[model samples]
Target: MGDTNIVGGIVKILETPEHKTFSANISVTKFRVQFPQFRNTSVVHLTFWGNLARYVADFYKINDYILIEGYISLRTKRISSKVISKSKKIEITVFKVYPLLLS
Candidate 1:
């Protein structure tokens, strides 16, 4: 079993989902979702492959609260320019998303 189940409001939609085709004609859609914490908020980059990608892109909108169940992983990237820099990122690989409606 994995160690991640997150429930939060969608504070911002970083980018609209876009479809990309890779080797073997494998297709994927990627987007970002922000979850506000008590004092600080965390952003999660998400990728949905194939049908789920299309469904989420069409069905979900900004500011919609959602419950996400998935696994968490850390991503690191190097930024190079005048000075070399390293950036660390946290992302959730979403298995399921449940829309939350508040009364």
Candidate 2:
């Protein structure tokens, strides 16, 4: 991966990994992480694909402090179903996961 970013934080949400077969089998996992910046909390959504997805689904849990190495991109999300408001969120396509501190 080029221009990869490394992020470290606590896992706030761990959604179940989705494993599906297309022409071939593929696995994807999504989760949220909360990191402290100054006095406030910042959150990021992480996407894990391939073999890492299976490893994460089996090993990681909430409150785990892990380092993510991947590419960062911004995405637009609807604030609410009834509202017209939209917000931009930072998302990372994780390539490698390091369980530096397990809780």
Candidate 3:
């Protein structure tokens, strides 16, 4: 399979705690970008896994702007009551975060 990659704006940040391990959530900002020929402003979500919690946390504030390049995916699991819930998640194994550059 070809490598999956996406470049978009960072929207929201979500953090969850499970016993000891932690997870991260980065919501995509609303903007239009060219994906070959299709342009879209739809918001995309990205999740940082494992030890990336701290790094992703410091990258964004309430309304900070950022650009993330990584893979896109979804995750589903059964909770305590055995209820299966789905989450829009991304591995985000490798990403480049860029802040504003003033010239």
Count of clashes in candidate 3: 2
How good is model 3 by TM-score? 0.41
Q: Which scores better on TM-score, 1 or 2? A: 2
Q: What TM-score number comes out for model 2?
A: 0.71
* Residue 23's lDDT in candidate 3: 45
Better of 2 and 3 by lDDT: 2
Candidate 3 lDDT, tens digit per residue, 44-70?
344444444445454444344445666
Q: Which stretches of candidate 3 lie over 4 Å from their true place?
A: 2-5, 10-45, 49-55, 81-94, 100-103
lDDT of 1 by residue, 34-99 (tens): 765533456777766666666777776656656666666777754564333567676666667667
Candidate 2: residue pairs that collide: none
Tens digits of lDDT, candidate 2, 1-103 = 6564565443444344343434666877787776644333567788888888878888888777677777788777765554435667889888888886776
How many angstroms is residue 20 displaced in model 2 relative to the true structure, after the best TM-score fit? 6.5
Best by lDDT: 2
- What lDDT does each candidate get? 0.63, 0.69, 0.41
Q: Candidates 1 and 2: which is better by lDDT?
A: 2
**Superposed Cα deviation of residue 74, candidate 3 (Å):** 1.7
